[model samples]
Target: MRGDTSPADGDKLGREAPIPRQLQQVQDDDLDPDSVKRHEEDDDDDDDADEGRDEEVAGLVPRLSDEEERSARRARNEGGAKLGRATTTYREGDDDYDDEDHLNHVEDGGGSRSPFADRREQRARRRKPAGVLATIWAIAREALPTLAISVLSLVFSGELLIHLARWPVFVKVDKLFILVPILLNLKGNLEGNLSLRMSTSANIGELDIRRTRETLIFGNLALLQVQALIVSLFAGILASVLGVIGGLGGASEGPKTAQRRGFGALLTKRRVIHHHPAPSDPSMRLRNSYFEFVLVIATGMLAASMSSAILGSFMCALVVVTRQLGGNPDNIASPLAGSLGDLLTLTILGLLGSFLVRFEGTILATLILLALAAACACCFFLAYRNAYVRELLSSGWIPLVVAMFISSGAGLVLDAFVQRYEGFALLVPVATGLPGACSAIFVSRISTALHSGKGVSSSLSHSSSSTLISALRDILKLGPTEGWIVPATLFTIGAGIEVLFLVLVWVTGQMSFGWPFAITFVITSGLIVAASLYISHLITLFLWSRDYDPDIYCLPYVTSLIDVIGQILLVVAFATATVLGDQITAAVNDHQKP
Candidate 1:
């Protein structure tokens, strides 16, 4: 009705739209122009009449050309306003409706939106969850090459034994075959324990190698020295006893030849020689045994002490450096150190043997022994004075010592069978070193898991598969790849080393066997890696579930088992090669006859 214009008033009515009742009441109050404007503003601010005003503006507006109307609507929509308005108005209590009003903002490219919000949304969309398979692939991607190189380094340790085999002292002392593996394995086991200890300490914030934590460093070093001395001395004594038992009631001709001549020949030769009593004095036998004893003990002490000092310091530094670099020392320290320990210990033992053998029963031997014993005593005293050393001794030292003895028995077994194969002696260091290297890797992983509280419960039952699964999950969480990748890679490295070593041995004329022997060596090396990995996993799981520190217990046990298993496998391989190799060689020789 207000917009209806009479025919006579059409021009006048066209000049203005009808005022609403609210503004008309303000106009009737006789307000000044500015006051009237203020009153009109008050009417426009009314929230309840917003819809009516919008409808009035839409309905009462003059008609536009079709193109103009479309353009106006497009502008209104694009600007996120009401259909006829140029600006948006958010109601006082309707902020939630703002998204609806701005729906076209996205269609307009959203350039007016906050960049950080858009970026956050984009990131959210991009960050999909990494499933189990993806995780395994990622972990294996990082670990495979590192493990391969580490294993390859260990495989080369076989060269040390090759050199040792050519040493005059090693040749003269038949019992060293029984002692070398034990001592080498002992060095790895001991250093591996030190690595684990240092890794755990670093993880727990106890490790500080900057001389301010000298007590902890000295305490650990002392414990390592004492453990090394005790274990190596015990290993030396145990190996000597086994050698005596195996060597007794036999001919003076080397055990290798005596075994080939048949036991009856050996015993008859012993009896005949006894009845006809060679002029050699019994004291000569005692003197020889004593000389072997001095050599084993002296070399053992030197190897243990020197390896502990050098490798212990190195592993500790490695762990510290890795941690500072935001990497897991657990992944790198043990494997690297284990391989290095094998090479260094064997080289050092060979050198010590060369020097000590020259002084066997001389006053120089006594002086060396006294000096070594005094140094060992000083280390033991320092270790005894440290509370941490006392704790390690009470809980950790005995198992390690026992493991050394058990590993010495494995050496005994190797000595018995490996003698039959002429150049199979070269396999000893590689076999023992490879397993220890693998065990060190796995033990470090498990120890890190334990220290980080990532898997297994403190009170979990030892037989629980959940504990094993948890432990495995901790490792497997590194990727979708199975745990066997490490062992398989190790096996590959070992096989390659076997092939290379065989070629070297053949080229050097140290061995006469052909591809059959090489194949057997490679196969045995693979089996050793696989067995070592499995045994290490089981040992770590057992120690972890039992609430014992796997670091202290795992290395020795795994390495000891590896020694035994590796020796057994090497013997089996050699026996297989011996039987089939002879036939293969004969066939080839027959074929070659022109």
Candidate 2:
């Protein structure tokens, strides 16, 4: 395919029909441009030829309109030229009129609507329902299994966090707890961005071809490694700073060993309690000092490095397989990324931190940190050299920071209500995850639409005021275009999944749910889903309007916003349920007793 170099070769490759002369020039510039330039000068030559022909055949000449004369001359001078640019054309060898008829149909300086476009519009009208149904079916097949797995994974992540918080390494090295929310938040952003980008490429057919697939996949992985390294280091540094602040607070209160706190306590701005034990060895004096800080940073980098390598590869493979299987990765990828990021990161963190702590006083820890730094520096250069990811490296940092800060608010809600509600931790994942995934699907579809060269995507892009209400009014116009189907289907699936998860928990006796809880959940989830979709749409348009790529910035902002909204909503739902849920449960029990 690469060896093929002619205009006809593009047709063989199954590119969109009617290759534009612009692309023709790109493929065969020297030959096609020279010919096209000469062809543009044909009117003068035709005039001269007409003058000579008139003199030679004056006796045989018949009166004709100027339009008819031009048509006749075109037919005579060029056998392959159309007899009438508007109605008729000639075909010779590979040179067919199909391209001109379908794509380049012209009435004057501007092209009129082609008959092909009309036929396409009619066919689309006929097949619209079937198309949407088929896509929804495919989405269900891909999404359901992955979502089940992801939801289960998040459940385990929540449980794991509870255990991990109490684990010796985390209890002793309290900064690690503070690192959880920050690093996981940043990692999700990195991976979600990767998944969305890959899904976009798949939708546009970039991943269908082997060469492009390899380039994109490799570039994305490199870019991911660069991002992971940076975020992990940042997490470690932030944790250390917080650790120092807590140490100072604890010192002023009493002569206590520096005590570490959970992500909820630290990020929520609660009073930090540090209770450090006396170091047994001279080398162990580093416990509350820079040595512990460097050690935490080192462990985070290792854990993050490993997690990104594992998760990034999985996401790439999942996207490729989904695309190959005629499924939509956009529906499944982000959800899994969010669901799995915390579990995997913490698993790596707890194990790696404990292992590294054993050698903390030795030179191995310092070497490991230095080595990770060098490796990350090398990855940065590698990603920089990649054309696809170069622009991305410079642009996405702001969203990660913003998302992290926004997530801290969620941490505050979590800390306050976590002790107040039964099984509150279990509900957190579904509350936040389902709504975020629903909106992520919308963002993925819209990003794909915005990146196209022409067609419906072009129709969707326009200048609008940067306001959520303006964006909402603009997006509301998409209903007539079948654009609403994507969000509708995604939300429908999400709600169904949310209900199923509730049933499963009820059956398993993991959490008791009454009529009031059900009503509150349905309302809260629905409200969050609606808000997530509109806000994500607003963010995407706002970024795109300012020349930011939605694929990079949208998901992080959307997920962070959803988490905040979801947490607040969860707290409200639980508060309401605590009142009504108890009464309903008591009434049901009394009826059974009677």
Cα lDDT, all candidates: 0.60, 0.69
Lowest lDDT sum, 10 consecutive residues, model 2, at 88-97
Q: Pick the candidate with the highest TM-score.
A: 2
Cα shift from native, residue 562, model 2 (Å): 0.5
| TM-score of model 1 vs. true structure | 0.58
TM-score of 2: 0.72
Q: Which segments of model 2 are wrong by more than 4 Å?
A: 1-35, 38-132, 250-284, 453-456, 459-482, 581-594
lDDT tens digits, residue span 167-271, model 2:
777766778887888899899889889989998777655565354467678878988988998999999999888877876685311111323233434644533
True lDDT of residue 198, candidate 1: 79
TM-scores, one per candidate: 0.58, 0.72
lDDT of 1: 0.60
For each of the candidates, give the backbone clash count.
6, 6
